[model samples]
Target: MDFDLPESAAAVREGVQAIAREYDQAYWDRCDAEKRWPEEVWRDLVAGGWHSLAIPEEYGGAGQGLLELAVALESLAEGGAGGAASFMYLLTPAFGGLTIARHGTGAQRREFLPRIASGELETCFAITEPDAGSNAIEIATRARLDGDHYVVSGQKIWISGVERADFLVLVARTIPAAEAKPRTNGFTVLLVDVKEAVADGTLSYRPIPKLGTNTVASSMVFLDEVRVPAERVLGAPDEGFAVLWDILNPERILAAASGVGFGELVLRHACDYARDRAPFGRPIGTNQAVAFPLARIKAQLELARLMTHKAAWLWDAGRPCGSEANIAKLTAADAAWQAADRAFQTYGGMAYSLEYPIARMFRDARIAKNIPVAEELVLAHIAQHELGLPRSY
Candidate 1:
């Protein structure tokens, strides 16, 4: 029941916060307005060594655990420099590079890990398709083995940071869902070289215009006749479904941490406004309406933060954390959105102004409800796994 972060994590938080504080709200606002990647902010974070905190030491990473990385990400988000886009960019390594470290071959690790650890290479992951949003088993992407290469073809939507990435951790099926011995056993992950695929005209991408989190653009990707060497296969052929856990579990935990930090930032803004804005001879915070919602949101965020840490702890301990991970994201997502809503209400007209960060926080908070795993899907997992109910889908 230790509520505090360990000294190591506290040090990470301190370093991350120091870098984050250097970038002001206006800098983030400019990035959003221009739809530009926060390269300066990314460089600052990498310079702080937070980028390689979770990578194994042999691969030139610091060999830290999920707990340490989550603390760094949370601190970054709360610092007002990294909104949803920066948070999402930082998460790419957790989902992409960490998987390579865990399940990739010795050669595969040697080829990619060092570049990834140095932040010289950016990674993006693709899982969703035009047809299958959450159902990985139903995806239509297929890879055919041909001599030393696998020829791949499919369309992927809502892929984040594809343009910024040197490569993509791609998911495709070697065996069709209908033809496989087990539906889940038909998929495979490949480390696809983006520049090579594009150079050869096998891959094409177009940025998908989004509402918020514009710092990192999400895009639609097309792959046709893309050929990747067999050596690039991440794990055993048709066993990628199991390997995906290496990405998904950490993704949920980090996403939870991002939302938790966002909620706290929103509450801080709301509280500041409530304490200073006076309308009826006293600060608006004197009104129960303003004070109560902020109070309640603070309480909920505390619980959500605890669940986030617990999920990270279980994951770092090499224990099964499927239930905890799902609940952590679900809890944090709801709290983040509610806190944003309260802040927007507290600021009223000023919230619409770009000068304040509330509008951006509100827009970014909306994404947490549907990212990595949707709220409905998490509830379904809890219903089936935790409540002893039969699977619905």
Candidate 2:
């Protein structure tokens, strides 16, 4: 419940921002225009150790909590875009390595965590299917047992970083739906080597064109009877849902934090434009029409920031944070959207022009409401968990 970050956390933010400042908006703008990934920035982050800040010290990481991780990611988004945050977190062990750390055995950790912490390897988590979407349990991907390996067959859409990742954390059904003890049962998690699968023609991928965050490539991946070593199975054979909890909370919180940063960046731009633009012999900001709404968005962003920090703190402390994480993501996404819209409106016709960064930030902010988890889904979780309403889905 601490309102202020500890000195160590503050130092992490300062260090990350210092490196991020080297890449200005113009550089990011060019990257976005070309649909190019930020390889230079990614390498710089890795060199500075900001990429491995969250991994445990024993595993060659700094062992920082999620709050510090959230702050660092938020600053990156504020400094650049969600692409930068994605590069930092997606490239790190947080996505798959953390899942393995929580549910992995000593052998698994020894096999993967250190290499992941050092950025020697990367993993992409494949869970979303075309038919399943948010209904993860409805996915039809199957992993059947073999002599010393499991044969996996499935299709996943919107799987990010697959082209560059060395391994994949895959979710597949180990038990048939008819025999599943619960609707969520029968799902299994496995880590598969991407190179071997592709070489064997068991895995294939095609890049998916997206509107934003183009720096991180997402793809439609197919796994046709891919063989994964038995040791690659994470947690139990049919307990993927439990294993996902360790990853999703951090994902939601990190997304919320990124939203807050984007909002702040928009607010700064809007305020600057409002102060300089003159209409009717007075600054446009003089009219309460523009100024009041902008002020409100500023307030909303601050409020979302508080909630995001709280959610990250609770999650890092090993407390149950499903409710808080949902609210944090919902509030921050809404606030960012509001701020981006106001920024667009404040910029008038110029807002629609690509020359101004607000237009891109607006598009990026809108995407925040949809991905990582949609706002509608967040509301559903809140209604059920926070208000004690019956589950809608």
Q: Pick the candidate with the highest TM-score.
A: 1
TM per candidate comes to: 0.97, 0.96
- Model 1 lDDT, full chain set: 0.86
Over the stretch 1-393, how does candidate 1's per-residue lDDT look in tens digits?
688888878998899888878888888888888988888978876776678777789988878888888888788888875355335434456866678878889998888888888878888889999899988889999999999999999999999888878888999999999999877888899999999999999999999888899888889999999999999999898899878887788888888888888888888889999999997889999999889989999999999889999999998889999999999999988999999999999998999998898888888898889988999999999999999999998
Model 1, residue 376: what's the lDDT?
Answer: 98
Clashes per model (N, Cα, C within 3 A): 0, 0
Instruction: Put down candidate 2 lDDT per residue, 268-364, tens digits, no spaces.
Output: 8899999999977888999899999999988898899898989988887889998888888899988989988999999999998899888778777
| Residue pairs with clashing backbones, model 2 | none
Report RMSD (Å) for each prediction in the order shown: 1.3, 1.6
C-alpha lDDT score of every prediction, in listed order: 0.86, 0.83
Pairs of residues at least 3 apart in sequence or in different chains that clash in candidate 1 = none
